[model samples]
Target: MANEYYEFFCPVKMVAGFKALEHIPFELSSHDASRPLIITDRGVRGVGLVDIVTKALEAADMQAIDIFDDVPPDSSMITVATIAALYREKECDSILAIGGGSVIDTAKGVNILVSEGGDDLRAYSGTGVVKSPLNPFFVIPTTAGTGSETTNVSVIKDDKTGAKVPFVSPFLLPDAAILDPRMTLSLPPKITAATGMDALTHAVESFTGLAKNPISDAYATAAMKKIVTHLPEVLKNPSDAAGRLQLAEASTMAGIAFSNSMVGMVHSLGHSVGAKCHVPHGLCMSILMPHVLEFNLSVSSENIGELLLHVAGSDVYASTPVAERPAKAIATIIALKEEMYALCELPRKLSETGSVKETDLEDIARMALDDGSMLLNPIDATFEQALSVLKKAF
Candidate 1:
C-alpha cells in the first residue's frame, strides 16, 4: 500500500448515523430532484422499510413519484426498461433505491435508460461505456453488505442475451448514500452474520489483492477492524443501534476499498460457487475466504500478516510472532465463522450449504477461472489449482 501509483475515487455523499433517512428530502432538494421514483423489492417493502422511508419523506412534505417494489432477485434488463418507462410516465427527476444489491442495480439501470433515453442496456454494457452522468440517484441499503451503494458497477441480467451484463462506469455512482440503523435493524441473525462476513471479506480481499494502494488500504483496514469488533455485538443484540451503524460504516468503507482496489480469488471462487450452487453470495465468501487467503499466502504473506492487527485486536497481533501473524489472521477468520455458525447457523463448509454437491466442485473451479475477479488475484490461478481450492473448501 506504500509508494505505488494507483487511482481511487468515491464522490457519492455519505449521510450516516441516527435518523439518516430523515436527510433524504434535503439531499433530494440539494440535487434539485423532488420527483424521485423509489426503487425496491418485495423483501424490503415487506419488512416495512419502504414505509419507513416513505414516512420520512411525507414528514418533509415530499411525495415520491412512484414506488416500484417488484424488483426480482435476478433483476433483468426488461425490469430496468419497465422502471424507465414508469419514470418517464411519472416525470421522475431522480431515483431513490431502497434495498439490497439487486434493487440498487435495477435503479442504476433505470437511471441509465431514463436519463440517457435508451431502452437497451446492451448499448452500454461494458467498462467506461456510459459517457454522460446519470440522474440524481440515491441509495439506502437495507443490508450492510454488497456495498453497491458505493460502487460504480451495475449488473443487469440481459434476458435477451442470457448473460448477466456488467455496466461499469463512473456515471453509475449515486448522488448520495444514506445509512440509518433503522434500515438494518430488521435483519435476522443468519443474514446479519452472512452480510457481516461478506463485508469483512471485501476488506480483506481489497487489502491483499494486487491493486491495493495506500488510500484503499486505509479504508480496507478500518473496515476490517470495525467488522471484527462490531459484528458479534450486533449478532448478540440486534437492537444495538450503534453497532448496526458501525457495521453499515464498515460495509461502505469496504465497498469504497474494493471499488478502487478490486477483489481477488475469494470473490472469483465465491462468484462461481454462487452461480453454480445457488448458495448465498455472502455465505460463499464466508466459507471460501480463509481457504483463498491461505492459497494466496505464498505471495501475499506480508500484507496478509498485517491484516491480523485489524482482524484481531492490536494486543493479540502484538503478542503473535510477526512471522506467524498471517496464520493468526486466517485462524481469526475461522473463529469468527465458528462463532457465527453457533449463533446463527452460518455454514462453515460448502457441503453444509445444502445447495452444492461434490460433483459441482469441478464445474465451480472451471467457472472461476473465467471470472474477471481472478485477474486481480496475486496468484495466477489455473483450473487445477482452483479445483484444489474448491475441493478443500468442500
Candidate 2:
C-alpha cells in the first residue's frame, strides 16, 4: 500500500432511506436545535416539500422560525447576505438546508455570517479560516449529487468579481445529513442523469487524482461500482425506491471521497464553465468528464486503470502493459459516458449543450487555471492543455 496515509473527516450523521425527512426533527434535537431556519430554493417551496418538512419539525416540537427560499441555481454572496439577515432577524439557532447544492451552500454561507456577524462572505475564503463552529446545521439533499451535504466546502459566487469562491472550513460541514429517497422522487429525469453523472465524476476524479489514498480509494471504488450499476436503473425508473436508495448512498460516498481528497481537471473546467458560461454545474461536469479523463490519462493511468477494474470488474491493466493502462482507462471512461448519455438521452458533447462556443475555449482555459480545484490535478496543466481538453469537449 506504499505507507498509505488517509484522513476520513465526514462529521455529518447521515440518515438515508425512504422516510428520511421524518427523522430530521429528532436529528435536530440531538444537536440541541430548538429553532431552525429552513433554507431552500423557491423551486423546492413550489413543490410543497417545504410544507411537509415544516410539519415534520412541528411534530417534533421544533420551531421553524424562518424559511428562506430565495436561493438561486448559482447562489451569490448577495443571496447569502440576505439569508444571513433573515437568520438574525428570526433569531434562529440552527439551519435546515433542504434542496440541492445551491441551497446547502447558501445555508453554509448564511451560517458564516449568522455565527460570526460578518457582512462580507469573502473574508472566510480559504480553507480552515473559520475558527469557531457555526450553528447546528443539518443538510437534507433533494438531489443525489454534489455531496454538499457531507462536504467541508461550500461554493458561492461573488457578484462583484464573477468568481466562484469555495468556503473551505471544518465548521462548514453539516452537522447532520438526511438522504431520503422520497426527496429525490420528484426530481426530473434530466436532473437525475446530470447529478448521477456528477457523482460518477467525483468518484472517478478522486480515485485518479494526485491525492488518492487507500481510504478514499476504497470509498471511491465502492461509489463507482454502485453508481455504474444503479444509475441506469434509477434513470429507467425514477420511483424505484431501491434504485434511488443505492444512488443516494453512492452519491454520499463519492462526496466523502472527493471532499477529503478533492477532484481534478473535470471540476476545474466545470466550475470555470459554470461560473462564466451559466451552464448548470452537473451538466458541465457531464459534458467535460470524458475529455478530462482522456487528458489526465497520460499521468493518472495506473490509478484510473485500477478504478476501471473496480467499477467494471475488468482487469484491463493485467491484459495490457502498464504503459497502455492509461489509454485503456480513458477509452473505458469515454465508453461509459457514451453509454450513460444513451441510457439517459443526454447530450454527449459541449456542442450538444448549445451553451458553449469554440471562441469561449480561451476564457474557459484561463478560468480553469485559476480554479482552486486545479491544484489537485495529477499533472500540471498548461493553458494549451486545458484548451485542447475544451476543444475535445466542444
Candidate 3:
C-alpha cells in the first residue's frame, strides 16, 4: 500500500547533452544575470575545462567577470571568504561553478557569504538556516561523481578546526545545472570509477533508507540502472563521451533522489571516515557500500531484492530467487567493486585505502553518531555497531 503522505521538491532546471556548456550564458541571461564569477579548482584548469567554459562564455558574449580556481580537494571557509570578497570586489552578479564536488561546494559556500553578506559561515551551519534565496548560481560539473550540481547541500571545512560544516536549504539549490560530456571526457579511469561508485551509493542509500517515496524511488532506480550500464562502459573506454554523459545524468538523478529522500548509514560512515582519515568521500563509500548493504539487509531486504533487477541485469535477476535476491544484489555490488579494482585499482576494503587505520576506527565510529544522515537510517546504528562495520570494512 502506498503511503498517504509524502513530499518532493526539485526546482533546479537542467540542460543536459553533448555541448550543454554552450547554454550557460543563455541560462544566465534568462535569469537576468551577467558578470558571473567562475569558481573551479586547479585540477579542472589542468584539464583545460576552465578554458572551455571561457570559450563558451566568449562565444555567447557574456564572458565571466573573474575566475577563482584555487579550490582544494576539500573546500575551506577561508577559500569561501576569498571567493566572496572577490565576487563583491569585481561586482559579479552571478556564479558559475565548474569542477567536481569540492569546487561546486566552494562556490555554494561563496554564494552564501556573498548573498547573505556574512562574516562567519559556521553561523549558518545547520539545515534550513538559509531563509532567503541565494545568488544566480549555476553549476557545470567536470566530473560525473558528486552530483553537487543538483544537490541542495554544501559541505565546507573549517580550516582551523578541521571540522566539516554542512549547509542545507532549498535556497541552496543551483538555479540551473549543465551536464556537458566534454567536461568529463578527460577524467582518468580511477577517478571515473570512484565517482561512478559514489553515485551508486547515493542511489542505493536513498532507495532503502527511511524516507523513501515514489519520486525519489523513480530517480534512484533510473540512476542505479544507468550506473549498471554506463559506469563499466566509461571504465573500459575512458574517452566514451556518451558513457560519460549517461554517468553524469545518473549522478545528477541520484543527487536529487538522495536530496529529497536523504541517505543513511553508508553516508554517515563515509562522512565520518573522510573527515577523520582524510580519505576521499567516494573512496570511503565505495569501500563501505557492500558492508553497509549487508548490514541494512535485515530491514531493507525486500527493497534491495527488487533493486537487484536493475543492478544485476535480467539473467542474474531472473535466476535469483525472490527470497535470495538481496544477497545476490550484494554480491553484484562486490563484483562491481572487484571489476573497478581490476580496471582502475578502486579499493574494495578500507585497509586498502592507505589512510584508514585500526586506531582511526573508534574515532570514525564515534563521529558517525553525530552525522545527521544517520537519523534516516532504517536500522539504528550504535557506536559498537558502527565500529564493527568499520572493522569488517577494514
Candidate 4:
C-alpha cells in the first residue's frame, strides 16, 4: 500500500473560458501592478496573440510598459538574465507572460532575478532555494499543454554547459492563470495533438505514481476524463470553442495534480530524451506514455484499470473483466495515440520523431536514472530496465 501521508498545494487563481484574456488587467490591478512586463516568444507574436493581450490591456487602461518577445523554445539562463535586465530598464513592476511553458518558465526566472535582486541564476537553481516573495506575476498560456501557468517550478537551461537547472518554490506559482480559447485557437494541428497528449501523460502519471493522494487523484481523474473526451473533439472540429476551452482547463487541472503529487518515469525519460535528442517535450511525452504505462502496470494495475472508464467509456468498462481492465486501459491509451496519429501524424514510436537515434538509447537511459522524477515512479527502474524500455520505445 502507498503511504497515507501526503500534502497538496496549488495557489494559482485560474480565470478560464472563451474570453478570459480580457480579465488580465483587472487581475493585475488587484495586485497594484499596472506597469507589467509582457514576456513571450516570437511564435506567439507571429500569430498576433500578444496583440490580443495588449488590446485587452489597453481597453482596461493598463498598457504594458514593454514587450519582450524573444523567448526561445528552450529557456536559457542568459535569456532570464536579459529579461531581468529589461524588466529593470523598463521600470516594470510585474510580469505578464503570454506563451507556452518556456515563456512562463522564463518569466518565473525573471521574477526570481527581479524580486530577489541577483544576476547569478545559479544561486536559485535547486529546489526551494527562493525564500522571498516574488513580484506579482500572471500567465496566459497560448498552448493547451505544460500547465506551467499553475506549477511552482521553473526550468532554466544553462547556456554555457547545456544543462537544465530546475527551480522549485511556491513563489514560482503565478498569481493568476488566464485560459482564453482565443489564445490557443490558432495552434497548428500537430502541436494541438502533441500538447493534448502531454496533458494526458501528466494526468496518467500523477494519478498512478507513488505519491498519489486523494486530492491529487481527484484532479487527475477529472483531467483525464476531460482530455479523453475533448482532445478528439477539438481535433475533429478545430474551431470548436467549447472543446478548446475544455482541453485548456484539463491541462490546468493536470498541472495542479502533478504539481502537488509529482510525476514519474514517463517525465523522467521524456525529459532525458527531449534534452539529448532535441525532440519537442510534448511529442516525446506523447510517444513514451504508453511504454511507461506498461512498465508501471505491474505495480499500479488497479489505478491504471480505473482510467479505462474515463478513456474508453462506460460501456467498455462494464463489458471488460476486472482482471483484464488494466491491460485494456493501457491499450486504450495506445489506441488513443493511433487515433491521434490518424488525425494528425502524432508519432507513436520514437523512431518517427526524426531526432532520436538508435545509438542514443544507452545515454538516454543513464540520464533517465539521474532525473529526480524517477524517484516517484510506482516501481523502481534499474539501468537495464530503463534501457530495455528505451529500446522497446525506439
Candidate 5:
C-alpha cells in the first residue's frame, strides 16, 4: 500500500536515560553555544538539581551567562518579558531550560523577545508568527509530564485578563531535549500521581480525539499502557528508578503523540479550569479525566475500548456486548481514577479541592470554547455541553 500523506515534525534531538545530564555539554558544544542562559523555577533550585546542571556545564567549560529561577507554577507573560530583557543584557546566545513545563515555557516565551525584539507578548499569540528561530535552546524536563521539552507550543498566562494564551510556532521547538529519570526521582507522591495522570490523559485524548492517525495511535496506545502499569508503582515508591524511567519514557512518548495529533475536551476544560482557579495543571487534568472520557466515549468507543484492553490487558470489547463497550471503557477509566486517588490521596471532585461554584461552570465552558484544543475533539462540544461535563466532573 502507498503511504498516506501526513505531517510529522519534531526537530529536537532527544537525549534520555539515567545520568542524561552528562550529555548536555556535548549537545551545547555541538551547537556552538558557550554562554548559555539557564531558566528554571526556585523549587527546582531548592532541590539542588539546578546546581547539579550548572556544575555539569561548568565542568564542560561552558559558562552560564545568567540563571533565571523565578518562574512560577503557571508562568505569566510579565515573567517572560523580564527574562527576555535579562537575556538581552547578558548577550546570551543560547538558553538551557531546566525544570518542568512552566520553566521551559517561560524560556520559550523569552526566546520570542530575545530573537524577535518584542516588548508585548500579546503581539505573538497565534501559530507560525515568528519569522526566525530563537536562541539555540535545550530543554531538560524534571517532570514526567507536560512534554514541553518536545513541543513547539508554549503556554503563558495573560495577567491582565487571566487568560492562558498559547504561542505556537515551529521555531518554538527546542534544539534538544534531555530527559533524565534522576531529575524526577525526588518528585513528591502528589506530583507523581498528577503528572502521570496528565500523561495518561494526553495518550487517551490523542488516541480518541479527531486527529487520530496511525502513527499517533501507536504512540498513544503504548504510552497509555506504560502509564497504567508504572504510575502506581512510582507513587507507592518515589525512588523506584525503573518505574520512574518507564514513566519518563511514557510521558515523552505521549507528549510526542499529543504534540502531533493534539488533545481534546479534557485539555480544553483542564486549561480553562486551571487558568481561572489557579489550580495545578495536572491536578485539573486528574480531576476532570474520568468525566471527559465518559463524555467522549459515545463517539470514540472503539478506540477507547482498544485503549482499555491495552491498559488492563483484557479484551473488554469481546467480553462486553458491542453496544456496551463504550460504557465499559468509561467504567475502566473511572476505576483507574479511583485507583489513582487511593494511591495519591488526591481529591476526586473539583469542589473537594476548593470553592468552585456552579456559577464558574459557564465561564469555564466559555473559556474552553476559545481554547485551540477544543477544535480537535472527536465530538464537537458546545458551551452548554462543556458546562455539563464540568458539572459532571464537579
Candidate 6:
C-alpha cells in the first residue's frame, strides 16, 4: 500500500543537449545577470572548460565575468568566505558554477553569503534556515554524479572543528542547470563508471525509501532506465554525445527524485564509509548498494522487485518469475557492478577500496546507525544489522 501523502518539488530549470553550454548567456540574461562569478576547480580549469564557457559568454556580450578557479575537493568555510569576498570585490551580480559537486556547492555557498549579507556561512547551517532566495545561480556540471546542481542542500566543511556543516533551503537549488555532452566528454573511464553508479544509487534508493511517491518513482525509474542503458555505452565509447546527454539527464532526474523522496540505508552506510575510509563516494555507493538492498529485502521486496523492469530490459523483467524478481533485481545490480569492474576495475567490495580494513567496519556501522538517512530506511536496522551489512559488503 502507498503512503497517505508525499511531496515533490524541483525548481531547477534544465537545458540539455549539444551546445547546451552556449545557452548559458541567455539563461543568465533572463535573470538579469550579466557579471557572474565563475566558480570552478583547478581540474576543470586545467581541462580548458572555463575557456570554452568564457567564449560562449563573450559571444553573448558578457565579457566582464569574474572567475575563481581554486575551489578544492572538500570546501570549507574559509573557502566560502574567500570566494564570497571575491564575489563582493568584483561586484558580481550572479554565479555561474562550472564544475562538479565541490565547485557547485562552493558557488551555492558564495551565493548564500552574497545574498544573505554575511561571511559566516556556518550561521545558516541547518534545515530551512535560508528564508530568502539568493542571487540567480547557474550550474554547468563537469561530472554526471552528485546531482548537486539540483539538490537543495550544500555541505561545507568547518576547517576549525573538522565538522561537515549542512545548509538546506529551497532557495539553495540552482536556478538553471546546463547539461551539455561536451562537459562530460573528457571524463576518465573509471570516473564515468563510478559516477554512473552514483546516479543509479540515487535513483534506486529514492525508489525504495519510505518517502517515495508516484512522481518520484516515475523520475527514479526513468533515471534508472537511462543509467542502465547509457552508462555502459558512454564507458565503452567516451565520444558518444547522445549517451553522455542521457547520463547527464539521468543524474539530474535522480537528484530531483532523491531530493523529494530521500534515500535510505545505502546512503546511510555509504556516507559513513566515505567519511571513515576516505573512499570516493560513488565507489562507496557501488560497493554498498546491493548489500543494503539485500538487507532491506524483507521490507522492500516488492519495491526492489519492481525496479527490475527499469534496471533490466523488459524482456528480462517479463521472463523472471514474479516471486523471484526481488532477488533477481539484486542479482542484476551485482551484474552491473561486475560489468563496471570488468570495464574499469571499479571496486565491487570494501576490501578492494584499499582504505577500508575489516577492523573499520564496526565504526562505519556505528556511524551509519547515527546518520539521518537511516530514519528513512524501510527497516530500522540496529547496529548489529548495520554491521552485518558492512561485513557482507566487506
lDDT (0 to 1) per candidate = 0.93, 0.84, 0.90, 0.91, 0.85, 0.92
Better of 2 and 6 by TM-score: 6
Error of 2 at 274 (Å): 2.1
Worst 10 residues of 3 by lDDT: 1-10
Tell me each candidate's TM-score: 0.98, 0.92, 0.95, 0.97, 0.92, 0.98
Model 6 steric clash pairs:
none
Cα-based RMSD of candidate 6: 1.1
Kindly provide the TM-score of model 3 when superposed on the true structure, using C-alpha atoms.
0.95
Off by over 4 Å in 2: 1-6, 314-328
lDDT by residue (tens digit), candidate 4, 54-159: 9999998889999999999889999999999999998999999999999999999999999999898989888889987899999998999898897989989999
Candidate 3 lDDT by residue in tens digits, 25-86: 89989889989999998888887989998999899888999988899888999999998999
Q: Residue 20 CA error for candidate 6 (Å)?
A: 0.5
* Number of the predicted model whose lDDT against the real structure is largest: 1
Ranking by TM-score: 1, 6, 4, 3, 2, 5
Backbone collisions counted per model: 0, 0, 0, 0, 0, 0
Native-to-model Cα distance after best TM-score fit, residue 79 in candidate 4, in Å? 1.3
Query: Of models 3 and 4, which has the larger lDDT?
Result: 4
TM-score winner between 1 and 2, please give it: 1
Name the runs in model 1 displaced over 4 angstroms. Answer: 1-3
lDDT of 3: 0.90
lDDT of 6 by residue, 270-352 (tens): 99999998999999999999999999999899999999999998999999999999999999999999999998899999999
